[model samples]
Every structure is written in structure tokens, then in C-alpha cells.
Target chain A: MAQNQSAPDATRRSERSRRAIYDAALALVAEVGYPKTTIEGIASRAGVGKQTIYRWWSSKADVLLEAFLDLSGQAAEAAAQDRPSADASPYGIPDTGDLAADLKHVLRATVDELRDPAFEAPSRALAAEGVVNEELGRRFVATLLEPQLQLYVDRLRSAQEAGDVRPDLDPRIALELFVSPLAQRWLQYTGPITYEYTDTLVDYALNGLAPR
Target chain B: MAQNQSAPDATRRSERSRRAIYDAALALVAEVGYPKTTIEGIASRAGVGKQTIYRWWSSKADVLLEAFLDLSGQAAEAAAQDRPSADASPYGIPDTGDLAADLKHVLRATVDELRDPAFEAPSRALAAEGVVNEELGRRFVATLLEPQLQLYVDRLRSAQEAGDVRPDLDPRIALELFVSPLAQRWLQYTGPITYEYTDTLVDYALNGLAPR
Candidate 1:
């Protein structure tokens, strides 16, 4: 009885420390940016020993990547709660037999997430660092961004199968027509991001600019 | 006679110094990145006094902006040499009667420019900094990027007039479907960039994904 009770207590303690570490990593990266954010700083902010963070993560980049993944998962969960019947898997884009509508739906949610203060600051910091740091930028793309893009690829492939998209077009490149424009606007502040804007992107992307 | 001779000589010397300063500024930013680059460093690398740089520009950002403009002009001139009859003005995309061919032509040139090592490093450094630095990022977009985008806007407007494009679609947003993808790929290292890739982007953008 004593051993079982201690095991539960130990697991709870580990969980709390893990959450604290993630919070600290996100907060520090947002405050000081990636270059200045250190493992020691994260540990200190979390009120945990350096060994605790080391035991879980190999580097600050590793910690930030995991923290961001956790944050994205939480955002997806919250978004799912808003529409209980919608697919909750963060790994896939929903396919309701309407490609344009589905893309606009997800992109609008992305606009909201990008606008959120909690997500924006840290994300900007990491994205900025990745721009100058080639290795980090590639890793960020490979680990975080590519996975999200692949969802679009899958959706586009389904559309192609349904004869909704052109059979000759590559899905990866086809998706960029709509997806990249929104990303560029958000990343560079080139234009205002709104539901109206994203919806327009979907429409333009589906139909050629030339008279059809 | 002496004064006239000296005047031209002085002008030549000033022009040489200006070019050298531009080179130094580009190299320093590319090497050490935006934050570490300073007026003193640029001057030192150019073998000029710091006062010289201060006299010509108000800040490092000012120097960089001008340097990039000069580099772009030089690139355009070089590209113009390749196609002697092509419009050399960097301010507008060529509107040869065939919209698809004209857009593809320009995007192919852009692919070459983006691949240039001399242009790539410094441009990437500045662009990366802009991602995280809100004020700088806005300035970079407003001054450097938006002007280039406006050229596409002009070409698209011409297309609309000729019935090549639908009258209802906003030219500004429509251009992003093609432009932003190339920009995102170059900036993020998300994928390979080639003339073939840009040509495909043009084809996809002009024709809607849905079958006619």
C-alpha cells in the first residue's frame, strides 16, 4: 500500500515539473528570443534544478520544439471543443468533401492562433531565429512546418482523386497557392489577415486568375 | 581649368567610396547579421571613417536599404543584358501581350536572382531579422518588398483590362497566390526552388485548380 501510494505521488511530481519546464521555456524564448534563452534560464524560471530539464531535453532547441508542439496540441484541443464533431487529430486537415471550404476553415483558425498573444510572441521569436540560423530553420521546417504542410498535401490528393483538383498538378505545389499567401501575410505583415482574406485566397486558388 | 579638373576627380573618388561602403555594409550584415552590424564596422571594413557613413545615411538600416536597392538595380541590368529587348526597369513586370508567358519569364529571372550567392546571404540575414523585429520587418516590407509586389499588381491590372483575368478578383491578393509561395520557399528552406517550380506556380495561379 505504501509503495503504490508513493508511486502515484512521484508521477504527479514529475508531471508538475514537466509542465513547469515547458511554460518556462516558452516564456523565456518569448522574452529574450532563442539566442539568449538558455537551459539554465528555463530551469531557474521553472524553479527546478538544471538536472530536471537535462533529464528531459538535450538542448534549448529541443525544449522549445517540444513546448511548441504541446502548445499547438492544446490549441487544437480548444478548437476541437468549439466543434465537437470536427476531427480532433492535430495531425490531419479535415476533408468534408469540400476542399476550398475545409482549407478556409483551418486557415481561419490559424489566423486566430497566430493573432493570439500567447502563441504569437514565442512563435515570432523562434521563427526569427530560424530565418538567420539555417540549421535551426531547416530543423523547424522538417519537424514542425512540414508535418502541417503534409496534411494539406493529403487533402489535395483526396481532391485530385475526386476530380476536384487537376490530375496533372502536384499536390505539394498546388497547396502552396493558397497556404503560402496566408503564411506570407502573417509572417511579414504584408497585409491584413481576416476570414474574408483567407476565404478569398481559397476562391482564387481554386479558380484560375484568368477567365474560366 | 584646375577647379573643373578637380571637380570631376572628386566626384569619381566619392562614387568609389560609396560603392565600397555599400559592399562593406552588405558583407558585414551577411557575416555578423543585423544586430551586430554597425556603422563603425561598415566604415572599418570599407577603409573609411565612420563620419563618412554617417554623412551619407542616418542609420545602418538606411545604408542597408540603399545597398539592396543598388544591388537589385545591378541585377536587373545584368538580366537585361541577357535579353536585350526586355524592359530593364525594375519598377514594373513586363506586360508582353501574353500574360502567362510574361509572368513565367519574370519568375524565372527571380529564381536566378534568389540563387545568386552574393545576393542570397545578405538578403537572408536582413530578411531573417525582419521576421522578429516588428518595426524593421514592417519597414523592410513597406520599402523593399511591397514595391516589387506592386509591379505584379500593375501587370495583373493590365491583364484584367485585356480580359485575360476576371474583373472581380482583387489583383493584389491574386498575385500572392504565385508570389508568396516562391517567397516562402526561399525564406524558410521549406522546398527546392527552380525555374520549373516557379513556372508551375504561374500555371497553377492563372488557371483554377478546378476543371473548367
Candidate 2:
């Protein structure tokens, strides 16, 4: 019956299973933490066979990483749904000729995403694990976090080229002034995250704190 | 014999036991994490009675918090020992009237402290737990992180008065522009932490990312 199925039917079924697996993985990690999340558990929760998970992902880490990436994509897509260019990649920030507005917009969306309960619990669990587990932490950063940070880097680079940013400063470090503050506040509960806070961050970052 | 002991002798014995308990609590948290590390465990490892720990700190959280504070104090003391005035408060940053230099000096010391193995392991463990545990995270920030940040706030306030910083800016948020970057790097393994990196953070934060 499987062999006789149409390719489109098979594709639809595969997509469904992948989504289910991702959901299961996120839920399991949120409830049980990373070290205890197993492929078998994910498979059971996903209503798929263990071989189905094994065929796709070699380890639980792989499954979780992909699941997180998928989740991030969904968050980004939701955030960008109202943008002017619907076909534009959700992974990149909008270049609206105004660095401050663009950054604030992205950060505000990040604030929303960070607060969403569906994202928060699993993200906190994974992030908590990453804090102590250096090897996994690096992998998580490399795979999930860095690419997102790179969006800021890319935006800053564009700002540099447009004369909106200081040409001499490193874009990588420059991006951190706004991004890391929000991240720390979110990760450590150091402060509140709000659109106002993020907007202020952009203002402070764009204008020198030493009396213009 | 207990009643025969002089005041100073009894104080010395108590201090020794307190130090031992702090060390044990830190070590246990580093090894077994926040949930698994217990009051009995710290007492056993420290070679002190469980009642002794209970007499001072009510829970493992209390013990770990004090341990971290003590460790931070030691780090600051070691970092500031080269100062001209030996009596200067170790918790406060140096104010040579140059805000940038003073900040660089403090941040560089922080770089050294974050890299210290004794502080690094236990701090990471607690930080990891705090990420997932909101109540603990807030407590950690309020007790451990906020006080350290207040040092920066104090420094920034002084700088504002001296016309070195914009008086309108909030010192608490302004400090995060530099501090949170180093924190994020250390916590998430997103980037390398070094004296040079922190120095750059201070520079970028004060000058703003946009052109002068």
C-alpha cells in the first residue's frame, strides 16, 4: 500500500510525521529536559515508529536541533507575515532605509516570540541545558542562535555601508549592544522585555550615550 | 569544652565550618546540578553537621547564593589588589576620573573571573538552572547579578555627574549594553570572552554604534 501510494500523498504524509516529531521533541524536552529526551520517547509521543525517527535523525540532539530550527522558522514566518514583500526570506531583517526602525521592528517581534508560551518553555529548557553543557551550548549557538545573530550582523553591515553605522567598529560586536541586552534580560530575568525597551535600545545604540 | 572555648576560638571554628559548607555546596551544585544537590550532601561533604548548615542557611539555594557571593568577593579582591588605596571597596569600580579606562579595568577583571575554573563550573550550573527556573532566576539576578550591576550603575551615575555620560540615560540599561554582551558570550558560548573583547564592548557602548 505504501509503495502504491502517489508521490504527493507520500510527501504529505512525510510532512505530517516531521511536524509531529518536532512537536513531540519540543514537548518532551520542555517536560523532561535535554539529557533525558530520547528518540524512542519522541517516536512514541509522535505516534511514529522508532525507525522513523532513526531514519531521519541519528541522535536526539539532531532531532531537537532540527525541531528548534523548524520552530524558529515558524516564529519568523509569523513575525514577518505583515511585511510588504511576502516573498522575501523570513530569516533576514527588512532593509527599510532606516536602521533604527528595522532593528526595533525585529526586536519587538523577538519580544513577542520570547513571550509566547509555546516557545518559552522548550526554549528555556534547551537554553538552560546549553548554559552548563559547553559542547551542546556551542552546537546550539552555532546552529540556532548564531544564524539569528548573523541577521543583526548583516543589518549592521548594511548600516555601515549606508553611513548609518560607524565604519570603524566591528559589526559583530556592534550588533551585540542591542541584541545581547535583550537576550540577557530574557535568559536571566535581569529585566523586562517590551517593545518600548527594545525601541529604547535602538535609540540608545544609534545615538551615543555621551550627549550627542 | 564547648563552653570553655574563648570568643575568638569559637569564631575561628565557626568561620572554618562556614567556609567548608560554602565550598561543599558550590562543589555539589557543580557536580550534580541544582535539583540533586541537597542540604545533607553539602553537610556531609563539608565534614560538618547538617544542623550546622541549618543553623546558618535554611536551604541549598541559600548556601549556593552565599557561596557565589563569597566567590565573587574573592574575585573582586584579587582583581583590585593592585590598586593604590588598599582600603578601597572591592565591590566598587575604580574611578580614575576617566570612565572608559575605569570600565575597561573592571570588565577586564571580570573577564579573568569568568574564566576562573573555581567560579566557572558552579556559576554555570546555577545559571543553567536559573534559566529554566524563573523563581530561582529572579532570585539569582536580584541577589547576585543586580548588586554587581549596581556597581556599574553607581559608576555610570558618577560619570553622568562628571559629564562623561549623558545624564538623561538610565544607568541600569546603559550598563547592560556592555555587561550583557560579555554575559551572553559567557553563558551561551556564542563568542569568545577576552580582555580585548570586553574592552571593545565598553568602547562600542559608550561611543554608540552610529557615527559621531
Candidate 3:
């Protein structure tokens, strides 16, 4: 009975330590960038032993990836809470049977997330490092970015089944039509990222620039 | 006669030094990246005094920007040489009356340029720095990227005049439908960049994703 009672307490303590480590990892990466951020630095910042971090994560990259995943997951959950009846599946884009409206809705949420200070700094730091580090860039895309992009693919495929999107179009590339522009704007600050801008992107992407 | 002859020699010498400096700057930036690349390093590599670089340019950023400009100009000239009678005008996209054809042609050329070894490394280095550095990012876009985007705007406007494109659409946003996807793929390693990929982007942008 004593051992069993201690197990639950230990699990709760481990969970708290994990959250603290993730927070430290993100904050350090945001402030110092990927190259300068270290596992030791994260442990020191989190007030945990370096051994504790090593037990949970293999490297700084591993810690950072998990940190970002947690951050995005929290953001998604918060967003879902805002729209109670919305598809709240953290892994999927909502399909409300209105392709354009659904895309615009998701994109607008993305704009909000991109603008959030907690999300923006570390994301920019990691993205900047990814730009030059081909290996890291590919890893980031595969681990963090590709999963999100696949959500768009699933949404597009559904749209195709409903005859909202052309069956012949590659969903992967088709999604880039609306997605990349907003991403470029946020990543490069190439333009203002607003709901209106994303709405226009969805409209122009669904309907060709060429006259009908 | 002696002074006049010496003046021409001096001009030729200056031009050679300018080319060497540009080459050195690009190579240094590519190797060490933007943060570590310095005016002294560029001058040393170019076999010129540091004073010579500062005499002509204000900072490392200034020298790097001009170096990129010169490299792109050379790339454009080489691309033009391949298509003897093509637009060849570095400042404009060809308006061949078929909006789809013209856009596809330009994007294919862009794919070639982005894939060029000489262009890719230094461009990626600079672009990587720009991602985290907001001031530099804005300057890079304004100086290097925005000018290229404007050519598309000009082409789209001409298409609008011809009634090939919708008159109500904003050319700026419309251009992003094709351009940003290519940029994101190239910058982020999100996917393979091919002539076929760019061709698809042009098609998807000009013809709606939805059925005709």
C-alpha cells in the first residue's frame, strides 16, 4: 500500500519536472537561439539536475522538439476552447462542409498563433537555424512541420471527395497555395498577416486568378 | 596621352577588384554564415585592403547585398544566354499573352536559379540570418525579393488588362499563390523543388483548385 501510494506521487513529481524542463528549453532557445542553447543551460534554468534532463531526453534537439510539440498542442487546445462546437481534434483541420470557410477559419487561427509572443520567438529562432542547417531543417520539417501539413492533406482529400476540390490536384501542393503564403508572411515578414489577407488567399486559391 | 591611358587602366583595375570582392563576400558568407562574416574577412579573401571595401560600401550588409545583386545579375545573364530571344530583361517577366505559359516559363527559370550551387548556399545563409533578424529580413525582402515580386505584379496587371485574369483580384496576393509555395519549399526544405513542381504551382494558381 505504501509503495503504491508513493508511485502516484512520484508520477506527479515527474510530470511537473517535465513541464518545467520544456518551459526552460523553449525560453532558452528563444532567447539564445538553437546553436547557443544547451542542455545544461536548460537544466540550470529549470532547476533540475542535468542527469534528470538526460533521463528524459537524448539531446537538446529532442528536448526542443518535444517542447515545441507541447507548446503547439496547448495552443491548439486553447483555440478549440474558444470555439466549443468546432472539431476539437487537435490532429485535424475542421471540415465544416464549407471548404473555403473551413480553410479561412484554420488560417486565421494560425495567424493568431504566429502572432502570439510565446510561440513566435522560439519558432523564429528554430526556423532561422533550420534555414542554414540543412539536416536540422529537414528534421524540423519531418518532425514538426510535416505532421501539420498532413492535416491539410487530409482536409483537401475530404474536399476532393465532396467535389469541392478537383480530384486531379495533388493535395500536398494544393495546400501550399493557401498555406505557404501565410507561412512566408509570418516567417519572412514579407507582408502583413491578417484575417482579411488569409481569407483572400483561400478565395484566390479556390478560384483561379484567371477570369472564369 | 599618358594620363588618359592610365585613367582607363585604373577603371579596369577597379572593375576587377569589385568582382573579386563580390566573389569573396559570397564565399565567406556561404562558409561562415552572415553573423561571422566580416568586412575584413571579405577583403582578405578578395586580396584587397579592408579600407577598399569600406570606401565603396558602408557595412558588411551593404557589401553582401551588392554581392548578391551582382551574382543574381550574372545568373540572369547566363539564363538569358540560354534562350537567345527570350525576354532577357532582368526586370520584367515575359508577357506572352498566354498568362499560364508565361508564368510557367518564369517559374521554371526560377527553379533553375534556386537550384544553382553558386546561388543556393550564399542565398540560404543570408536568408537564414534574415529569419531571426527582423531589420535585415525586411531589408532583404525589400531590396532583393520585392523587386522580383513586382515583375509578377506587372505581368498579372497586363493579364488583367487583357482580361485573362480577373480585374478585381489583387495581383500582389495572387502572385503569392505561386511564388510563396516555391519560396517556402526552397527555404524550408518542405518538399522537392522541380520544374514540374513549379509548373504545377503556376497551373494551380492560374486555374482554380476547384473544378472549372
Candidate 4:
């Protein structure tokens, strides 16, 4: 019984330390951005030794990636709470069988996430770093961005099966019609993102801009 | 006659200095990126005084913007040489009455531009700055990006009048389907770009991503 209790306590302690580390890493990255954020800074701010961070993660990039992943999970949980189904994750695009509606829903949620202060600062920092660092840019795209984009691919594939999307269309490129526009607007500050704007993108994408 | 010849000589010298300044600004931005690129640095590298840059432009961003504008004009002129029609701009999207083909052609040119080593470095530098800095970001979008995007808007508007595009579709948002995807991929390293990829994007945008 004592061993079992000690195991749980240890797990709880580990969880606490992990959360603290994540918080520190996110805060430091937001404040100073990726170029200046260091392992030592995160460890110091988290009240953990730098060795402790090294024991768990190889680099600041690793720590930040994990932190961002955790943040995404948390955002999903927050998003899930609003939906009727308890089992659904808010992390992926909704497949409510209406492709346009589902896409619009996901894109709007993305807009909200982009606007959220909790998500914005660290995201901006990582994004700014990605702009200058090719290796990190590719790695982040592969790990974070590609997976999220794959959700769209999956949705588009489902649409293809249902005969909702063109059979000849590449799901990857097709998804970008509605998706990348929002991303470019957000990432590049090219335009305002209203629910109206995203909704309009869905409509324009679904009907050829040419007379259908 | 001698005075007229001397005036032409002065003009040529000034033009040479201006070109040198533009080259230096582009090189500095590529080397150090936007935030670190300084007017003094551009001046030293151009072999011109800081006052010379100040006389022409108020800030490094101004100088860089003009440099990009000049570069874009040069690229357009180079592209123009390959065109069959004497009347058509090599820089302008061909209005061949087939909206899809015209869009694909222009996007393919953009794919080449995005991939070009000469264009990539400084373009990336300005784009990276646009991601984090709102003032410069907005200005770059307005001055440089919006103008290029507007050209697409113009072409789309023409397509609309020709009954090629839906009368109801907003050309501005409609253009985003093909345009923003390429922009996002280039800015974020989201994916590899190719003529095939751009062709696919044009096809997807021209037809509803949904089954026609």
C-alpha cells in the first residue's frame, strides 16, 4: 500500500514539474522569442536545474515543441467542452458530413485560436524563428503543421469518398483553398479575419469563382 | 552641347549610385534580416553616405521596399521577353479567356519567382519581418503585396465580366484560393512548390473543391 501511494505521489510530482517547465518555456519564448530563449532561462524560471531539462529534452526546440503540443491539447479540451459529444476532440477538423460546414467550423475555430492570447505569443515566437531557420522551419512544419494539415487531408478524402469533392482533385491542394488563405492572412497580416471572411472563403472555394 | 552631355553624365552617375544602393540594401537585408539591417550598414556597403540613403528614402524599410519594387520590375521585364504577344505584359497574367489556364500560367511564373535564389533571400527577409512587426507588416502588405494581389483581383474582375466566373463571387476572396496557398507555402515552408503544384492549385480553385 505504501509503495502504491508513493508511486502516485511521484507521478504527481513529476506532472507538476513538467507543467512548470512547460509554463516557463512558453513564457520565456513569448517574452524573448526563440532566438534568445535558452535552456538555462527556462530551467531557472521553472525553478528546476538545467540538468533536469536536459535529462528529459535534448534542446530548447524539443522543450518548446512539447510545450506547444501540450498547449494544443489544452486548447482542444477547452474546445471540446463546447461540443455536444464528450468523446470528440476539438483538435481536429470536424467531419459533420457537411464538408463546407465542417471546414468553416474548423477554420473559424482556428481563427479563434490564432486570436487567443494564450496561443498567439508563443506561436508568433516559434513562427518568427521558423522564418529564419530552415532546419527548424522544416522540422516544425513536418511535426506540427503537417499533422494539422493532414486533418484537412483526411476531411477532404472523406469528402472525395462521398462524392462531395472532385475525384481528380488533390486533397492536399484542395484543402489549401479554404485553409491557406486564412493562414496567410494570419501569418502575413495580409487581411482581417472575421468569421465573415472565413465563411466567404468557404463559399468561394466550394463554387468556382468562375460561373458554375 | 557640352553642357547637355555633362547633364547626361551626371544623370547616369546618379542612376548607377541608386542601383548600387538598392543592391546593397537587398544584400544587407538578406544577410542580417529586417530588424538587424541598418541604414548605416547599407550606406557603408553601397559606398554611399547615410545622408544619400536619407535623401532618397526615410528608413531602411523604405529603401528595401523600393529595392523590391525595382527587382520585381526587372523580373517582369525578363519574363516579358518570353511572351508571344507584343501587346501582353510578361508581368501581367494573360487573359486568354480561359480563366483557369491564365491563373495556372501566372501561378507557374510565381512558382519560379519563389524558387529563384536571387529573389528568395531578401524576399524571405522582408516576409519574416512582416510576420512579427505589425507596422512594417501592414506597410509591406499595402505597398508591395496588396498591389500584386490587386493585379489578380483585376484579372478576376475581368473574368467575371466575361462570364467565366460567377457574377456573385468576390474576386478579392476568390483570388485567395490560388494566391494565398502559394504565399503561405513560400512564407512558412509549408510544402514544396512546383509547376505541377501550382497547376493543381489553379484547377482546384477554378472548380469547386466540392464535386461540380
TM-score, every prediction: 0.96, 0.95, 0.97, 0.94
Per-residue C-alpha lDDT of model 1 across residues B87-201, encoded as one tens digit per residue: 6364467767899988998899999999899999999989878877888888989988898898889889989999999999999999999999999998888899998999999
**Which prediction has more favorable TM-score, 1 or 2?**
1
Q: Which ten residues in a row are the worst by lDDT in model 2 chain B?
A: B82-91
* Span of ten consecutive residues with least summed lDDT in model 2 chain A: A82-91
Q: Per-residue CA lDDT of candidate 3, range B1-212, in tens?
A: 99989999999999999999999999999999998999999999999999999889999999999889888888777767766375636546776678888889889999989988999999999998898899999988998889889989989999999999999999999999999999999989999999899999999998989998
Alpha-carbon RMSD, each predicted model: 1.6, 1.9, 1.4, 2.0
- Please identify model 2 stretches exceeding 4 Å from their true place: A1-6, A86-88, B1-6, B86-88
Supply candidate 2's per-residue lDDT for A203. 88
CA lDDT of each prediction against the hidden true structure: 0.89, 0.90, 0.91, 0.86
**How does model 3 fare in lDDT?**
0.91
Per-candidate iRMS values, in order, are: 0.9, 0.8, 0.7, 1.1
What would the TM-score be for candidate 1 when compared with the true structure? 0.96
Residue-by-residue lDDT tens digits, candidate 4, B58-104: 98989999999999999888877766684345667788787888888
Assess chain B of each prediction and give its TM-score: 0.96, 0.94, 0.96, 0.95
Q: Which should have the higher lDDT, number 1 or number 3?
A: 3
- Fraction of true inter-chain Cα contacts (below 8 Å) kept per model? 0.89, 0.87, 0.89, 0.81
Docking class of 2: high
lDDT of 1 by residue, A104-180 (tens): 98898888999999999999888888877889989989988888899888888889999999899899999999889
DockQ of each: 0.84, 0.87, 0.88, 0.76
- Please give, for residues A24-126, the per-residue lDDT of candidate 2 as tens digits: 9999999988878899999999999999999998999899999999999888877777677833366799888888989998899899889999999999999
How do the candidates rank by DockQ, highest first? 3, 2, 1, 4
